[model samples]
Target: MLKNIKTESFYDLCIEESLFLEENVEESLKYLYEHGYRTIAINQSINDDNLGAQKKSKGSNKKVKNSEVPPPIDLSPLIETVDKLNLRGFQIFNRLTITYSNSETFNKFIKSNHYKKYHLIAIIPTTPEAHNYACSSAVEADIYSYNPENKFTARLTRKMYNKIVQHGYYFELQYSHAIEDSTKRKNLIHVSHMYHSTGKSKNVFFSSGAKNLNLIRNPYDILSLGFLFGLNELQCKSCVQHTPQQVIIHSVGRRHGKALFFVENVEETQENDHNDLSNCEPQKKKIKMIVDADVET
Candidate 1:
């Protein structure tokens, strides 16, 4: 955890705060802060349907083609709100949530510089083809977020899950639905069970995805919900703690262009790695060893 962050277990997952009709982003954030949520990612949703609608509304006959990256929903308003709140040790991140329709959507997405502006990117594969692509190498995203109401269905394979994890993408379960209705709770549990059946619940993260502060659950309360959703005690806790931590680290990697581990702008030293055998070693060292934390650390 960062030095200023006080709440250890809470990462609010990702939410579309910009979509809220009457909620005060600042007040909602302050309420979250009071409840010990130290980090939150504000998501902007994107997909072909919405993207095309904008053009249609503008009366532009230009058919939506490839290499299209939707313009970001400005965060300046929310940022100003944060500044007004005068909160400290709170981490706010801009996130893009892409609902993929095809490889072209993702292909165009990665090529677009707009995505680079976000601290994190999440994807919802609405179709089986998109889901398979996400589990494969066709897309880039930190979190695989699917709402229970979306009723996502696909045959998940253990190998696919492992491959996605290998690429640093983790699965996310949004809890607002489960908190609201019994049917949503049952569906969420079913999804979790399917996820666990294919892959272990090790890196599964839980999110509130709450538009109103009333819908939000405390960090520990989330763990209790996870247990109801079929996670074990450790896995349940990790959903709020370990898994969210991984999401943050993964986001940093994307923002920094490390792709997980590569350090940027590292200068080569003139001296050899070993002191006494300085001359024996090459002038440029193959790698430098130093005391530091892992990319996630």
Candidate 2:
């Protein structure tokens, strides 16, 4: 038997790891829920520099184990709190965001089982080669995110954007930094313009990327903010609702094959089979015998 997994209607996919460390994290979640975010992903960012350091410390020849990657934060306690609060259908998913300058190191990280623990995998390529490799190569990832605070070093051409969209990857635009600082807002808009020029803002979605509770905004506000990112009303709406849902579905499919449902085999007991047979009455069949005779003709 196959079944569909239930996902919440609204999502704010990029809540930062710092927010989870706060003393009032539960309160923060409550506020977000109140604001109508039913699903949220806590993002843990890893840089290629850190991976290189670990590789150097362990010797370059040795295969890096799962321990080399930063483990996902324990969300059990937060889940319990949410349960106690009676937040129905609320979902918290773990996300791994790798910012890589080197494609080899990125490949090695993705090859490890540790990276699979996350519900969503996002990559931020710092160099042109890394960016091209990420887009063109058969990398296992769900989202392509960029740092709004920093200027993009990698060239984002039209073909690259098209390839990314064709690969079923969503480009994330974090709104929190835009809300926090003018300089970051400018940089964020510049990046958004790039998306607009290259791809006409296709396959783009909005995430909070919120460091604290204060940075979080309602979905409607995010919809309006989407306009500044070159998204029209319908496209803006999709960024918050339809596109995020598709991103989650894509991540699920990435981890668990392309099938919408998992298959399970159910065995029938002999007694049940006998009972089923007993309910049916047997019918007698009459057969007419045909005699073929090569007559005198």
Candidate 3:
């Protein structure tokens, strides 16, 4: 849908590294800004073990009732970097990727008070059960992430992928993983094929997913890379632009449990319509004569 709308530049929504960290804050943002990235996100990964519960639910699936949760990640460090670089129209967002092995853990984390803190929430489902949950309509997250480095034995059928795309779920393709190993590149291509089978490859979110400056590539270069991976021109282009924007929009809405408040093209109306009033002429003040009661009465 955003194919016609031209973007001056594209966004790298999944930066595996942090822009606020003392180790690479300056270099990361500088490289991204130089490469024409208007927006970037810092993604932190929390493993399944850290999901606050070691036990799984023994019964059939139902709405999550209650469970303890791990401590929330401290995002206070990234707060200052929100507008760090003086780059024009730059944005930095905090995102968290949680890994879950079972639906119970996923449910508990979703029910946490800390769920809404991040601008984006992504899930890394290591098992088929978790994968089902991740792809289901009941899951409320921006991205269902699969690492290119990992091997996937579970199959994602066409029906499941279609349903996921229909529910506005997006998948992330990390470039850093592809760059690190040839096996990962093959894995990425294979998975891309599965997703393309859905006929809604527009739901893909392509990103550097870089933890270091060396791994980062310009958005245009990534677009070229997408072409090599079997993505059509439109899908590749929207990967960095429209797809991520929609992800953020939906994630923000999910965070608030509703859409964020916004308004545009609001104009102030004239208190009285001068043009309508121009048709009327002011009437002369009515004159009244009072009887001289003081002298006669």
Candidate 4:
């Protein structure tokens, strides 16, 4: 249901002040881990955590002349915390929408000392018009629009995808419908869901785009989404195990403070393994245990 189905789970979109708040941090990671997500592509200007300082800065200013004045906010701390999370990866946009200061600002930011260890997850602009300035050298470029009905997201996706396919450049459609519509834009890997709230988004956990980006209970979510997509028992089981090995590999990388093991078993394979494990010898100090975890560990 959720496996290799949706294109993208662009979860990290929020105001800078709201992004790195303690509660949001715990919620985001917990959601990722619980849903078996291994990949996270942090977006620019979203998921920011500088609300407190922004408020203080605003309070300090009594008179405001320019209506176009930017919000008063300090983004240093949010940047620091994101750097420390050891996240799978995050995106970098050269020119953010509010300022739209041209690609030069974005180019400098990408090379600046501030974003050294953090890899570029994606480069998304507010609309398709902005994609021109977003370079092909950036990891990937996302053309964003809030309205699901917008034609810019759809049309530019096709044009950019065609131009960049040979270069391995891909598009991540934001606020778009199930991308099953665009067969030609196969490189556009991920798709965002229409669901806005948590409960409405229960189906997102099971979607498959990139492995690490999935929400954990995602396997179960996939099972349900599978039903919607008309899959069967064997197909569903295969779906569950589609990337089991990959998940295990990433879990190990996190050094999650737990010993990890990988066991592959089919009906016949399990029977053979069971017999071999059962027949293993037990020493005086080490008791042979049939429980897989006890013995395997």
Candidate 5:
């Protein structure tokens, strides 16, 4: 849908080493960016542990002890790779799972790169502490990908969602299952099945994952995500604009030059249309102070 509409750029979060292995890092990122990919998110995956364990374990009786725990993951490797991403810049950094007790260690890895400037979007489980952490941290986050089948999960998830937004963080929610006739092509809205099944409210507050968005056949489906969040046509157009003009006007004291330009245009047109007709002729410029004041003798 985005391709058909010729959407200029996309923010790709959670890119993997597999992508780099399958295609060379420089080539892959360049190709994607040249073809309208804008941002890349370097995130550690939840399945990394499984993959690493499988790679290390070959013998049947091989067992790892708790005392000999693996060292903390250092993200310096990914940060180095980022330096070579010439075309696709990273807008956000993310950690795939915050479920581990040592997620703070991972957070430390990201914070270590103080020189880097980007939004950190870590995953947060549906827990009170997790919710509080996301709200308090300068880093923003989204709900962790998990089953929301039970009432407890839903309630906690909802609380986390509210907390993230209240703290001025944007979040994304994914559906565990598909809904029938839920996504309409005309408007391209993805209604939440969980919300519908649980008799909860359904709207554009939820966003389907990038994988789901790619499968959509309608152009509107891609754009409706923004529209659902109350973006009108002009605002939407401005969002897509190549270079948007920004203006800062002081409400109390300073006159806005841009506003005055239009105001002057209107006044000039109005004066031309309705002339002062007491003289029944074109008005002359009266130098108010000079002409009205007689020389005192």
Candidate 6:
């Protein structure tokens, strides 16, 4: 039998952090769970300059440390609300999205140990050098995302897209921006076409990136909107389902080592144990069996 498996059909990995800070955020989460979303990631975005400023404010001349990194937002209240509502299997994750233009700052910040506090790490590169670093060297990150509302200075080439996918990183496209404004919608579509033409839409997933409850779209609506971004039906479904699942699995593997196991045919194992008992003598001392240490989260 499979153990510790989650088979949810929908995932939204980019709910903006601002929404969580709002007073009615609990209501927003309830709406998402009711609309078929089982997994959600609260995203907090930070830039290289901001990190530098924070470090300087602390009067630190040495290399940046984990203390300089922003701590994950408190979700205890949200968790309590979930418990009160008894929403089973509703998972929430903390995600960090780093926007970087300087390679040096990005490298130092990416290596900080505090990154382990987040369930997923994403990077947005604004320069050609930083873009190359993200595509080739940012192995610790799970997703590569950019702001669709603003024009990006770095161009995405087919080679860069392939390299990113080959490195096991998923591309995130935010659809809420498309629904919020015409200018953003135009820019999002343009970027989506870039992904289509350059990468054939491989390893691409759609996220809400919604700052408010009204900005969030239903999963089915997102599937329909996928076609406008040059994705076929299967690709659209994978964006909300399979691809996002893979991204979660990838993030888990990145945080914990890539070790997994499953127990199959439980009835057969029980039967074998029963049969072995008939031939074996009872021991006076208990047998201590030590298995390898479980993977730490």
Which one wins on TM-score? 2
**Model 2 ranges off by over 4 Å:** 1-4, 57-67, 258-261, 264-297
Q: Model 4, which residues run further than 4 Å from truth?
A: 1-20, 23-28, 41-102, 127-129, 135-154, 157-159, 173-297
Candidate 4, residues 167-190: lDDT per residue as tens digits? 222222231123334532222222
**For candidate 6, what is the lDDT?**
0.79
Q: Which stretches of candidate 1 lie over 4 Å from their true place?
A: 1-9, 19-23, 50-86, 258-297
Cα-based RMSD of the predictions, in order? 7.7, 12.5, 15.4, 15.0, 17.2, 6.6
Candidate 5 regions exceeding 4 Å error are 1-9, 47-96, 100-121, 126-152, 156-160, 174-221, 224-297
lDDT score of residue 123 within candidate 6: 88
Instruction: Give each model's whole-structure lDDT.
Output: 0.70, 0.80, 0.68, 0.34, 0.34, 0.79
Task: Give lDDT: candidate 4, residue 21.
Answer: 53
lDDT of 5 at 230: 44
lDDT of 5 by residue, 77-153 (tens): 44466566643343223334333223443354344332122223335444544345555544433333332221223
User: lDDT by residue for model 1 over 1-297, one digit each (tens)?
Assistant: 122122355678676754433466667777888887877777777776566566567665334443366666566676677677876656677778888777765676677767687777888888888888887764667898886776767777788788878877888888887878887777788888888887876468888777667888787787677766778778887787777867876666556544334433334434434552656754564443322232334
Error of 1 at 212 (Å): 1.7
- For each candidate, how many residue pairs have backbone atoms clashing (under 3 Å)? 0, 0, 0, 29, 0, 0
lDDT score for candidate 5 against the true structure: 0.34
Worst 10 residues of 3 by lDDT: 288-297
Rank all candidate structures by their TM-score, best first, as comma-separated numbers.
Answer: 2, 6, 1, 3, 5, 4
As for candidate 5, its clashing pairs are: none
List candidate 3 stretches off by more than 4 Å: 1-8, 50-84, 258-297
